[model samples]
Target: MRVDEYNSFANQLQRYASALSRLESLHIRLADGCRLRAYQKRLAQVTVDPRSAIDSQLVIAVTYDLREIDEVNEIVENLPATLDSETLTLLQKVASGSEHPDDELDAPGREAQYELYLGTMLRRGGIPARHGKPDLVATWHNKEFFIEAKRPASAKGFDNRLRSAVHQARALVRPGIIAVCVDQLVRPADGLMVVKDFNALAPSVDNLVRKFVVEQAHTLRKRLSTNEPVAALLLTARVPARIAATGHSSLGTSIQLHPLLAGSIEAKFASSIIPLFAGSPS
Candidate 1:
């Protein structure tokens, strides 16, 4: 994503606050004492102060909270006037508690959010898509494409997650792509991504993501070699970063496409669809 396109910390916070208020007014059943609600309350207590000393833990929490809110807002804003049962169910799941204790980024809720996020992005890219049985079903150039998104909390579980997504994608009658959020795989230690200037943010983030992708190129190639239905591995990451120059923080997102092979049918499909998802060539 471009630097100017990134949402400011204050903007994201305000967006979340408004979203939370709207949900409350609608009588949506958000979890009692949800961490997201708490994060909003805490963030409201202070303004962005670059020099202010804040706990790294709070920064991490706020970063994830803002990203989640943005995702939820995207999904909500794009929904059709009449809500389908499937979409409603997915929203409810997102509103539920985190899948694991003391961790809001785990499976179930975050996982559902990721699916909706992907669908939203695809639609924004002018591809007709929606969250469904195969995680996502999208149409481009009059052809349907199935997508399966996964968020593995750790590297140890990545293989299994990829395998599962591949299985799901292969079952579909249309072409498929496996999208994985590799945040945990490349995330730095808490508080490590403090940048000094806005100009440096994008390069710093790109370097981190690129380095990881390069290091794992062999492993990724090995894993996707035999997965015929899977046209490509869409690896994505969102890192929480603090900008000392602005005294604020935001999530930096990076996406990379690793095709199964060059000059093949699947590779062509992946190349054509990836620009839509990434908003540019990956």
Candidate 2:
């Protein structure tokens, strides 16, 4: 996505959020939706970048990071014995927040975050959404749609991963949202397919990113064209940095999608997800 495109997306979301807030409140059973709504009340939060840390106000709780349990235990062991319980708790929380940020996020946490992302994105398109039993359900054109999102480790088993998500969406019995964070998108024929190998801007035109994005987009268009139950599939891509550095992938709003591939996305999803509130989006 270009800078202007991302900006436009965010701006549109704010407008939708404001519109929904004006509606007569309805009873909703979605716990996740409730929390997100409360966090983004009045469309108060704004994202400068998708990859940056989320604003504190949008998160209901500050979770303790336990990714480095050994390191955390070592810190705990060295604490002074005379410290009061409250003081020790505060210290541990601080250390966990700073030193062990990735620990507590298992698959569920990641899925929950992407679920939040989708609903957040929908609201950006002026759709009202909530999360509960079926991951998420959003309102548009006076109709409710179910959205299910998944983050697999890599694209090696893309079919299997999507199949699992598809099953979940099928159970929802509504216009379903299926989203996938592109962990590893590669054909089985490749030999050394690291994440970095796929770069659209690479000197070699046949880079991995281009191939994967095109193939993935084709797969999605074909699936949607077949009268599949899913309304849309969101594929969030990431580029992991070098190994010696943190084993983290930096995601950005600047998703440099291929023109042909992104058009497939616009046709399948952007065209339908918020049609009631939007005409053809750029």
Candidate 3:
């Protein structure tokens, strides 16, 4: 879907009060001072005057929180009985940790959200996935696969996060995928990304993702070479952007898959499972 189209749909579908009530129904309550509440207030201010100066960071937070709320709601609705505890625990963590003063990218809330997001995506893709020790686990083609989702706060911490995920996967003794969200790495901190036209949105985001992949290529290759259980690295990023011509705001997302060495058992497993996520969300 086009970026603006997604923004319009999401904005229409997600309302803060409704989302909060849905979470409350699930026994998850957010503190009044939580970052999400702050985002909602910022969103309200923006809605009051669309042409006013926009806070780029607030825009990113609002967009991200909306999608997260929607995804989590769907997860709870379709969740299997066995995963009830796991899902609730993660949700509770997100609710509680969100109020922390230092709850940035490295906060437990962010990590739990990432796990929930991946589990939601996997389930939506027709794979039976559950949240757990390695973050997430799923069954595809009669084989169980583990997934460790990580979102480093900064580029310098990427290696450590990757190693931690690899270790978790190795401990499980199952074929696995290391899923990393590189939004912080790709997103510009100064301001929202501006593209000349709608057509430029995707390529602008893709170029940033490609650059990140290239910079991390050696590290990823070295990890895959030694970690037999890890079949592939899945990198995903979402950047808040605006179209200069139309003055429309949206998010540009990119997802890329990097497989293990050419002729390995792990690589073969990755190939077999790739089809399951063919049309996964951006």
For candidate 2, the per-residue lDDT at 87 reads 29
What clash pairs does model 3 have?
none
Sort all candidates by TM-score, best to worst: 1, 3, 2
Number of backbone collisions per candidate, in order? Answer: 1, 7, 0
In Å, residue 120's CA in model 1 sits off its true spot by 0.9
List, residue by residue over 1-282, the lDDT tens digit for candidate 3: 113224453453455556666667777777778765665565566666556667766655555554444444454544555557888898787654443222354656767877887776677667788887878877777877778899787787788898888888778775678888887777666555788988888788878889988988888776667546777878877666768897766667677777765565555544554444334332
TM-score of 3: 0.81
Which stretches of model 1 miss by more than 4 angstroms? 1-5, 21-27, 47-60, 97-106, 217-219, 261-269, 272-282
Candidate 2 lDDT score at position 95: 19
Quantify how close model 2 is to the true structure by its C-alpha RMSD in Å: 15.6
Candidate 1 — what's its lDDT? 0.67
Per residue, candidate 1 scores C-alpha lDDT tens digits across 99-155 of 222354356767777787777777777777766788887776777777889987666
Worst 10 residues of 1 by lDDT: 97-106
* Tens digit per residue, CA lDDT, model 2, 101-178: 122233443344445445545655566665566666666567666666675544545666677776776576655656
For TM-score, the strongest prediction is: 1
**Shift in Å, residue 88, candidate 2:** 25
